[model samples]
Target chain A: MLGDQIRTRRELLKDADRRYSLRQVAGRVGIEPAYLSKIERNEVPPPGEETIKKISRDLELDPDVMLAMAGKISSDLQEIIRKRPLLFSKMLRALKEAPDHAILEVVREVTDGDW
Target chain B: MIQLKGTNLVLRFPQVHPKAKASIEFMRTLRVPNDGNTYPLPAGLGSFELEHIEDHKAQLPEDWLKRGGVMLPMFQSEAMWISFNGTYPIALKVATGKINAITGELWTNELTDEPQNYVVLSEQPWLDGYAVEQGTVRQFVATPLGSGESAEEQITGEAAFGGIQIQAFPMKREVYKELFESPKLTDEVQQYLEIPAFLRRCSEPAMGLVPGGSIAQEIHKDEYGLDAWDLSAGSRCFIHTVNSEAWSELTDLPMPHKPISARDYKSANIPWFKYYAQDKKALPGSAILQKLKSKKEKPATKREDAEIGQNMSDLPVVKLRRSDVVTEGVF
Candidate 1:
């Protein structure tokens, strides 16, 4: 699924403007073209976080989205979770089934709330 | 179902497929001069702010509340274009004031092929206005309701509605998997396999879209057949356009400032856009739409050219070529 997302975004970008090639993208992200092709085909697992970040930058994709699809959390997020793992785990589980608008309401409240 | 994310409306069909997602955003742009000359694609300044009618039920009319959709504010004579983004293929029907933008017919719930009434997403990125010709579209310029300038008024002899209506249908699951899930199917094979294919008016001040100057754009024919769309699985929404003054009175939100003039934008050397997809086929112009008179052809309303400056003759345009996936990068 991670591979599909990356490949689809790349193909869309290229389709819109003829901007990049798979090989060119791999080269820019410091990966072998064959390896990148394998990743796109879902023949292999997604690359490491650093490589994904590089790819995201080149493709102009959200790094958080890429990292989430790769099944890895960013270090900063991990640090935040480590601070209060139990509370965060409960919050995450509770918000799992909520709709996007409800989740957005929570985000808005937090953003505007007085600490 | 439609979810308001910021200013964009994200339409998701979970029943159809997990990847069935599409977004619609009304982009603000410079209102091209209707001086009897077609122009290039204008730059997208930003998305218009959208608010749910349910949130402001007390201020809006009963009809709008019953419609239960979103609304945005637009300055008189302001121009807009609809931008679309989809994760997978989607069939979208866009109508302004209950008039089909593609076929120029009264709003219909079903899809037809004799003269396709809808546009397929992922192939068609943005729609500026009515499909007047094979490779040209009239720009959407906002005018006040009851001014006899809206397409709805010109076509149906009434300004009953003054907003946009949209419906989205996702591709069937089996068809999607057959086309996209299999890794063996290349882009070329996918291309080759496919077969060729509003609301009540107002107590509050309202704005309706009218045809402006023509622009070089194409409405791509549906490569997928009619069967590909799951008619059973569809979602529709109504987007009401309110005049800026009434919008502020009702919602208590500040209206967006007027967009830069075409002359000013051209003087700043901002590049206009031109998209080209040689493989895709463009639909022929709609006779009904072609027959309708443009804003320039009719007598100018009192509110038409208050802010519009002199029309510029030439503009700087950037050409966007189709992607070449087959080409390999030189190391």
Candidate 2:
């Protein structure tokens, strides 16, 4: 039964990889295609928070898109954004427009919020 | 299009950058005055280190930035070669910073990511040329907002950037050819493989140098080197992967809780690839002895094939059975 579950999980993840070609994913997410392929093969795990947000937006995936996988669990930082869409939205806006310091401000806002 | 022909690889870039033009001059510095020996770094030509910086709102302008942004430093360690297929668009970003106990380096520096669209080689008429191909970039144009009205929506369009062919590997042209026997692959193929390798290598935890599991398959003595495999196998096997954007998502997770950095890492399994301290799977006694001993179970000889095609039986797969448990204080 455990083996069966593992097979199912692999199939599901494979579906995600096929759903988005490396080029298409890079276009939507802003990461390069070669790096994307690395993730699919599990050579490396998913990238950090900002990269994840970009991937989520590019793939139009749920905020917990990475939660579907194994290895390292989602970071508390990601959990904060997952639980609070407003904060995530504000963070994205800042990344797009604010200066480098603004990223810290977004981090502060997320950390200060009620969990 | 400028074609740089080597024994193994052929590279063609549609655009060229001004820095590449400068690199030609830079290459001269690397070349020996009379003996023609390329000196090592510092004395060879110039050298710089790469650093990674993270800033949420940092905007990159057209001009080059000495340091800034979500930078991924890359080096052309050893000898490098470049050429243009048509026109070339070249852009280079260099990073530098001091080492830190927390993350090794603060990685606080990053240059802009704009490609140099043109080059003017005054001395050498052959080298002096215009870029033939355009680069890929998306631009957003916003209309002005009215005094008492909402702002106008922005419009995006595709514009032509310069294209230039470039490659940097540990081996030099002649030496690389001698080492590999066959020529190196075209820049197009190398670029396709190298970029991903760079991101994964630079970002992932440092462990080993090998990119993936070096699985050895038995080589058969047939009329054609790899003909039998193709005849038996209909479709070639290929390992598909997730797109870069989805992969980058893993980086956002908290330090300890984040997914594994899929880039290369040392492994306990497959010591032949040389990732672990404990070695297993010892090499079999060589072939000469096999003739004396009664012929029975012979180990497979893995032959390297240059053909770029599909073989269902020989699909490449990276088996990452280990879990990444980030201990406290490692980050």
Candidate 3:
């Protein structure tokens, strides 16, 4: 089931950018090659919400998509709601505080949630 | 940036071919000040600088000898007079010293350690009009853009009548070298000089590239019978980069960060044409429709009048709005 979700996310990313390679994605997420492969293959359940966020950030994937895929919808969504109130608040925060576009990509995940 | 007060005239070449050469020549003429004393300057220059003396009593060089000199018939910095005509009621807080425009004498405690001495005008002064209150009037200051702490805040009040003429008397080259050689003044002047040159250089080409004003777009209509507007891009202006000569010299040493500043070229308040489909049924129809639409073009809008204030020479000598509105407080 974990492998199925990882593959599904990877396919979505592929649709966004056909040329984007796994190593590029891994480098962006700051995860080791073996660890990323293990997670992708379902040898490990989805990494914690932090890791999912880091991956989403590095890959420029919408954070909401990552949260939905990682099954952290209820818990992770609550954490962001508690911290930053206002719709598109995360996007606003990312715009000011994030250092680079990579940081924006990760924060974007939570901002553009399932709704 | 330094604001130079003077009438800026674009010498129209009714039908001159090769625009680039003509433009370059036009810029060169301004450097030739009206004073007969000449330095090593190009014989053939485009632009020239002129000084308006006080009520026909200017200590100018003789007419035949000063043939090369270009004299502006009306006062330079006419914008100040024009803007002053529509200025609001403002209390002028004059600095402790007197600035006699006729003598070019600046007597202030700050000038000399002994609490009194005069310093001659060393920089080109500009008509810097600052708004005392919105929808009322503006006050003019004789701020030599780079010489002041900040260009925006150095404005002094205008005269009761619309006109106040000040001579831009030239200072000695030695004085300029002494005043400007300092690192701070050099840096400020360099930055100040860059803008006018940039404006002159970029105005034609930049306007040519962008259909209306820096935003690229095509016309389209809405679902309703009415023509709906579409904006291709918004909130953008050209900023000179490190590669530009104007920016390059400022970074001769290892700097903390890049000093890149941009001024807003166009805004919503300023009028701009928008694209709209002539027929509402089609998107970007065959006739790429465009309409000149301005939200702030009404008579009451102050900005439209302010723009008209800038082109004062072209405007008819209309009676200033509410002339009594400001003068009542003074009496």
Find the candidate with the highest lDDT and give its number.
Answer: 1
The 0-to-1 C-alpha lDDT of every candidate, in the order given, reads 0.76, 0.23, 0.27
Per-residue error for B31 in candidate 1, Å, reads 1.8
Candidate 2, residues B209-303, lDDT tens digits: the string is 00011112111111111211111111110011111222234234222112111111111111111011121221222122111111111122011
Model 2 iRMS: 21.6
Mark the regions of model 3 whose C-alpha exceeds 4 Å error after superposition. A1-45, A68-115, B1-331
lDDT by residue (B1-331, candidate 1, tens digit) is 7778888888888888998887888888777666556666776766888887777777887767666678889987578888886657889999888899999999878888778889988677788888999999988888887888889899999988878888888989999999888888666435422211000000337788888878888999999989999899877888889988688788877886665454555555555677777988999978888877766433353223332333333545555544422222111
Error of 1 at B230 (Å): 0.8
Query: How close is every model to the real structure, measured as TM-score?
Result: 0.68, 0.15, 0.22
Question: Which segments of model 1 are wrong by more than 4 Å?
Answer: A1-93, A96-115, B186-204, B296-314, B324-331
**List of clashing residue pairs for candidate 1:** none
lDDT of 3 by residue, A32-115 (tens): 878888887878878887777777666566767777777776465677777767755656565676577555333221010010
| lDDT of model 1 at position A76 | 88
Best candidate, TM-score = 1
Compared with the true structure, what per-residue lDDT tens digits does model 2 show for residues A91-114?
677588777755543332101101
